[model samples]
Target: MIALPPELLPQLGEGLWHLFTVFLRVSAMVSLLPAFGERSIPTRVRFGIAVAFTMIVTPAVPALFAQPNLLAMVRLVLTEVLIGMALGLSLRLFVLALQTTGSIAAQATSLSQILGPAAADPVPAMGHLLTLAGLTVAVLLGLHVRVAQFLIHSYTFFPIGTAPLAQGLSQWGVQQIARSFGLAFALAMPFVIASLIYNLALGVINRAMPQLMVAFVGAPAITFAGLFLLFAGAPLILSVWSDALITFILNPLEPPR
Candidate 1:
């Protein structure tokens, strides 16, 4: 048997450590994405996906894994993890806007009782549907390619070991968060308006027939109407969602030039 080279071991160890850091960063990002991070997704599967992604991404950003002392290396890894998480979370916030709309629509349609898993949080059935719709729109619009492009661009704005933390993050992240809310409310507006009309009609009906049980009649009617609206508007809703997702992913970090 041939003897192995002893000095090569340190170099190999350093490379492995750098790879590990990359994995951590990628894993953190994946762990927060809509379907990828949802509770229904098994942990082992997410881990495997994260590892595979890291393997693919590591080679592309060679500057990230350049040689450094142990302490500097640890800082680099931490920065990567922070920046990746921030980026993923920013995208995920838009999904929350959909979730918020869902919850409101569900309540308005009197279907809030139905519930499902959508993320780290539990959501009403309508909310869950909205979440799924948003994710589907993202995928159909070539989100995989966008996400890859976004990650590659990160090395430019944030670099490897110098991602901004507390002070810098607050200044940069607030506007994105506010925009997400604006987009979410706009997406839900149609359903919201529909619900208001339906409720107003119900109110008129109640005022006319005091003996009738509006509770039973209103519940089923609202639910059915909400479902119908959802089916009718899904395509349009998804179109807006896809556009918002593109905007979110394309400029996740620095203010757009």
Candidate 2:
């Protein structure tokens, strides 16, 4: 390895000190991201990714630690981490919304218990499927690029080395949670309506043919209908979910119309 001259060491140390403060924020943010935050990923790999993301974000939002001593550096670390986590968590809510939608959809279609324990989050097969697909689509659509842009924009809302307003943050968080659940319900409404109709039809048919085995006939019919509905509607459901997620991530501060 090539060694730098002794005089350059102090300059290098200063740069690294600023970089480390930035690292605290970027790493916290990445820890909440969908793909980057998964528990299955190794800690070492995630740290490396945090380092890479720090590099991408640092140039855009210049470090505030220009002449930081120990106490100033500590404050920078705390403030940066808080801001990063706030930004990352806003996006993570959308992912949680997707999971909630999937679980509701699976339950509505009577497919909720297919190897539930096998999943990392213990979601049904359908829920797991949709979540995976949605995540893949997000990545392919360039989530990393969007994240870098988001980091740059965040500095405008949350300045360096400043504490966020507690009351304002709390209210915004409540609003976000409500919005997430509303989105989940909206996505699952179709399946829920289908289930209701299927049940009503089953009741009518059973009443009209009391002697016949309605359970035997209705089970397969409903199952087939559910499968067909999923096949036909999965694309639309995913499309709506993904679009909403991306839109919110790109425009976090925009009020929904």
Give the candidate number with the greatest TM-score. 2
Collision pairs in model 1 = none
Q: lDDT of all the models against the reference?
A: 0.76, 0.80
Q: Indicate the worst ten consecutive residues by lDDT in candidate 2.
A: 58-67
- Per-residue error at 102 for model 2, in Å? 1.4
Tens-place lDDT digits, model 1, residues 1-257: 98769999877877787687667678888888765676678999989877877777777775433677888867777887888898778778878888887877777777777655544567788888878878877877777678767776776677667768688787677877787777767777877887888879878989999899887887777778889988998788878777767876777654622
Off by over 4 Å in 2: 1-13, 65-73, 210-213
Indicate the residue-level lDDT of 213 in model 1. Answer: 84
| Model 2 TM-score, 2 decimals | 0.89
Tens-place lDDT digits, model 2, residues 1-257? 99899999877886787677667878999998887777778999989888888898777776553667789867777878887888778888888888888788878778787666555887778777877888888898888888888877877788777778899887878888888889888888888898899889888988998898887877777677777877888888889878887788778877654
Name the top lDDT candidate: 2
- Which stretches of model 1 miss by more than 4 angstroms? 1-17, 64-67, 115-120, 204-217, 253-257
Give, for candidate 1, the lowest lDDT window spanning 10 residues. 248-257
